[model samples]
Target: MTTYLPPEVQAGLDDARKRALKKSQRLSVQAGEETFRVLEAWDDGFALELAVADHLRGMVDLYDGPTLLSQCLIVASEEDGDQMRFEYKRMTEATGEQPVDFEKPENAPVALIGKG
Candidate 1:
């Protein structure tokens, strides 16, 4: 069963879908000098439109807007009509933030215990 929508209505739906996709896809991937939007991501992998995935491989950087998130070596994992998934052969965090180890002596605050 199929319902026909007027051309204008169909166009409006298409526009809305595009806007939603743009809003939801907050991350981007950089391969060499080119960049592509990441449609979705997880700890091990991410997806991109098949057209974009075609040009990418090996080492790439993932970014959240202008901030670098991680560097990965990605290989194709799956593909469907319009999208492809990539699994990380390797991934490393690119963020400046480091995990805190409060127990580490170097991380402890410096103080003169008797002077205080």
Candidate 2:
């Protein structure tokens, strides 16, 4: 079956992809027992939610420019009219680890376009 995402969600994802390409940097996030790169991010109004694969080990890290922020998980397209939300508890747990591998092309999430 085809997965259908809300229009807002799609727009958020698209914005994230553009941002990632423009920065030319990969993001690392921890899921369960591994670290993975967030192929793309979806705007959820609060924070930018990332679409991640594998690398699910400890906690997720979000790097913007020279600053690196940690969070448990990134949620996208939240109804709160925000970009994303970070779970502080999870982020504090994982520290000092190798960067996760972000599988490009195949693992990338779909971007969305905001209306009005």
- Which candidate ranks first by lDDT, i.e. highest? 1
Q: Across residues 1-116, which tens digit of lDDT does each residue of candidate 1 receive?
A: 88999999988996686467668988999998889888778889988888657657899999999989888999988885567888999999885767877657766677656755
User: Tens digits of per-residue lDDT for model 2 on 1-116?
Assistant: 98999999999997886576545545545445554444444442123333433112234556544356555554332322322333243333335766679645876668977898
Q: How many backbone clashes does candidate 2 have?
A: 27
Q: Give the residue spans of candidate 1 off by over 4 A.
A: 1-19, 97-116
RMSD to the true structure for each prediction, in A, is 4.7, 20.7
Give candidate 2's whole-model lDDT. 0.47
Report lDDT (CA) for all predictions.
0.83, 0.47
Lowest lDDT block of 10, candidate 1: 107-116
